[model samples]
Target: MSENIALAGADLRAAMRICMQGKFPGVQLYAHDGLTRDGKPTAVAARAACKEEADGRKLQGPERIAALTACFNGKRPDLAQRSECRKEARAKGLDGADLRKAVDACAREARG
Candidate 1:
């Protein structure tokens, strides 16, 4: 049986908010799932900007991880590293709940 690792939804949301706030004041977030109208990630430039914001936050440990996951949720090809990081987390049996917590932490840190 495959072990289920949960990611923290709150953390993920927080991280995403932090990452997005830093870059965009009211930009909408979207999930790509490796598919788009052209079979590729859309809004590449916007996604790239968001990634830059996340990277600039300098989130460490789980917080960093959560930020990356949020980036993937947006399907930003510019954030190739984040996408890979998400894959690695899944491979290591990391859960979404845990990731969410990390994201939340990042958001709090960024806001403060």
Candidate 2:
């Protein structure tokens, strides 16, 4: 995972606010779009104006994690890796000889 995940748009700012307060609404749209229509840019550009507002807040570990989770669309690559392993064991769609490589591929393709 990247050290910094850019939180873009006004909506994201609001989500961050809620997350900092130790709350993450499951039904809300944390990001305007997690992955764009075209997957060229892996990450969004940081909005400088919102940076000041975001930086001012101080949150505990869980709060910070919650905020980051929403900001990143709650994608867990680790979960993807585990699922890939199970699929590979079933020998269904996955035809890869190396289980480790197959799991890695599945994780890399996960959208966030």
Candidate 3:
């Protein structure tokens, strides 16, 4: 693990050096074109992602959201409740940004 971290650090340092020297294209660095793995245009991918996020957010009503919050925070003592929450999340397609936000919020609350 230490060796891997050292190698990654070295790679990042090399990249930073190249960027500092202005060897890398500034447009390529800032633009999303040709950056996608699936070959879809950036705008198409972004629109689809936004629509998916909206759908996921819309799927969870206030009650479902409260359940998710409780489950994520481990406030629900019963394992079954957690299981149910997972099932519901999957059923409602909680993924991507919405899921990330939920988990992050729950983590913050847990830390406090």
Candidate 4:
């Protein structure tokens, strides 16, 4: 694992949040030209992601997050993305079960 990749929850979130909120300064999203399958630049996907994040923040507790983490193995999210997730975990104090979940998630993705 690269030292840049935080294998833990809180640490990873801190790095990631920094990147997402533009704190890192030069990072850019290489998304699909902000377009959808319908050839529309509506940014619906971006809006939905933001909405989902807001909604997820409402669900308190690590167990709740753990359940969500258990289902989605995004197949080894890149170091940058993992950093963002770690940043989010830090803000939310997701250091317990969430940390375990993050480790398990990394392992699962690596295995695949």
Best by lDDT: 1
Report the C-alpha lDDT of model 4 over 37-71, residue by residue, as the tens digit: 44434344444554466467675577546544432
lDDT of 1 by residue, 1-112 (tens): 8997565786876777678877987654454342454555555544665578777997778887788667755665444544455565566677779765554554455446
Sort the candidates on TM-score, descending order. 2, 1, 4, 3
How does model 4 score by TM-score? 0.22
The clash tally of candidate 3 reads 0
Query: Candidate 1: what lDDT?
Result: 0.61
lDDT of 4 at 76: 21
Residue pair clashes in candidate 2: none
Q: For residues 13-92, what per-residue lDDT tens digits would candidate 3 score against the true structure?
A: 66665676587555344324523444333444444554465467664677555645454334223333444545555577
Give me the displacement of residue 15 in model 3, in angstroms.
Answer: 10
CA lDDT, candidate 2, residue 24: 50
Backbone collision count in every prediction?
Answer: 20, 0, 0, 10
Instruction: Locate the minimum summed-lDDT window of 10 residues in model 2.
Output: 40-49
Query: For every candidate structure, what is the RMSD over all alpha carbons to the true structure, in angstroms?
Result: 17.6, 16.2, 16.5, 14.8
What is the C-alpha local distance difference test score of each model?
A: 0.61, 0.51, 0.51, 0.53
- What is the C-alpha local distance difference test score of candidate 2? 0.51
Per-prediction TM-score, please?
0.26, 0.27, 0.22, 0.22
- Residue pairs in candidate 3 whose N, alpha carbon or C atoms collide under 3 angstroms: none
